[model samples]
Target: MDSIPSGEGLIARMIEGDESAFTSIYRQYHPALYTYLLRICKIPSLAEDLVHDVFLKVWEIRHRINPALPFTGYLYRIARNHAFKTLKKLAYDEVLQEKVLEHLQFQGNGPEQMVNEKEYNRLFQEALGRLTPQRLHVFRLCRQEGKSYDEAAAILGISRNAVKKHMVLSMRAIHNYIYRQGLVITLLYLAQKIF
Candidate 1:
């Protein structure tokens, strides 16, 4: 029910800033790209965001796109890179949150504590932004909302094992990111839990 455009012609029009050509390319590739990202990250929302980011990057670099080259491959490479970067950032933020939480434990629970709590909340949001939509939902339900794995699974309509898997992978990513950031002292605590 859909028609495919000539890649070379589409790229040429995109280079010249043709909105219609860009739209054509987007419509053609978006579904595949989103599916690919969702499979790798297991997050529907993140997949959509990655697709958006990939297309935006494509547009920004349209002038440089080689019409003679394989467009699909080039676009996929960009998507993969974007996904990796997003994952890394998410991991780093998770570790950073742990560090912040540890520091908060030492401070008196008062106005200063409230200010730190606010900062923690901000960082928590940033970390969540890095996760795929499904993963974010799972994390919030399980951790933030204080729901059990079974409860989250029922709420999300996923298996209990699926919920556990997401949590483990998410926590592992956070620990690995913290280790990579050279936070040795914090890593010690995280490693115990992650390992």
Candidate 2:
């Protein structure tokens, strides 16, 4: 089974300039963080690039991210800020995806590629949107933003157990949807990554 080192230890190591720890952190948080960015930036490639950029910033400002503080919140704050800035500079429309992608140093696929990724993203975001608002909020806090259950619970005014339940329900719903569509192999790989 795959495992993530404990958050505090990882944060301490990262604070001490351990690249391995930061890499582990980047891998651990990549999926949810990327999805969150995709929802904002509305493009897979841009989201992926933003994830890399966010980590680069994190590594550069490692001293500011206190090991004693929750790194998850810090990470999400950076992502949200970067994504918002990107959205504003690009003027917040389909016309802007390519421009933002270019500024982010990615391929400039005019409209067709953008359309396809946006279509898939629409379905994916819709799936996430189907959850109860509280559940969706918790899922975003815990999975999408990499917050610990307790931390998320505190942020959302819920118990830790509720946080765990929302996460399980979100995963179960997504994997079941994927399975019904006969995407078991792809779902299995995603499962391997997140779990």
Candidate 3:
């Protein structure tokens, strides 16, 4: 079925115990939640299971949903909380924790992985080159030189909070630049493999 036009209407029907409306909600949000949970947990199978659990909770608490408010925010709140809780539980279970860590560790240490890592590092350097001079100085001081924020602030003649803000913005800019260039890197890798 196509997605319902009005979220409030769909949610109202869901609140009234309409299974179809609930199904519509599930179909609408499933992919986004899957991607989100997968990013947090880094395990596809576990992320799928967690998405199901999150929706189950949503169904159980359907009556509490305020249809007038934005549902995506509510859904993401539940997903974020559930993901963190599951990770915490995994951390406490030594056997399970070892298995998960082992799964992550051997995902790919091959030549292809090395090439991708190199590409990512190149992208990172490119991103760093785009930073403002002061931001670059702050980044080098705190990250490259391993200076404390207070020390960087004193050297730069800025407040500690200002140094902190520069670092945050610098990281954000670098991440966004790399993320935007990631598709090109992936396609180049694919082309190299095919050729």
Q: TM-score each candidate.
A: 0.48, 0.47, 0.52
lDDT of 1: 0.70
- Candidate 2, which segments miss by more than 4 Å at Cα? 1-4, 92-195
Candidate 1 lDDT over 51-116, as tens digits, reads 999999999999889998999999998987777666555445765445344443444322233334
- Cα lDDT of candidate 2 equals 0.69
Candidate 1 ranges beyond 4 A from true positions: 1-5, 94-195
Residue 193, model 2: Cα distance from true site in angstroms: 28
Q: Rate residue 25 of model 3 by lDDT.
A: 91
The Cα error of candidate 1 at residue 20, in Å, is: 0.7
Per-model RMSD to reference: 18.6, 22.7, 15.1
lDDT of 2 at 61: 91
Better of 1 and 3 by TM-score: 3
Top lDDT model: 3
Q: Could you tell me the TM-score of candidate 1?
A: 0.48
Candidate 2 lDDT over residue span 52-142, tens digit each: 9899999999987778888888998898887666554443344553444353334443232333455546556767877888888988888
- Of 2 and 3, the candidate ranking higher by TM-score: 3
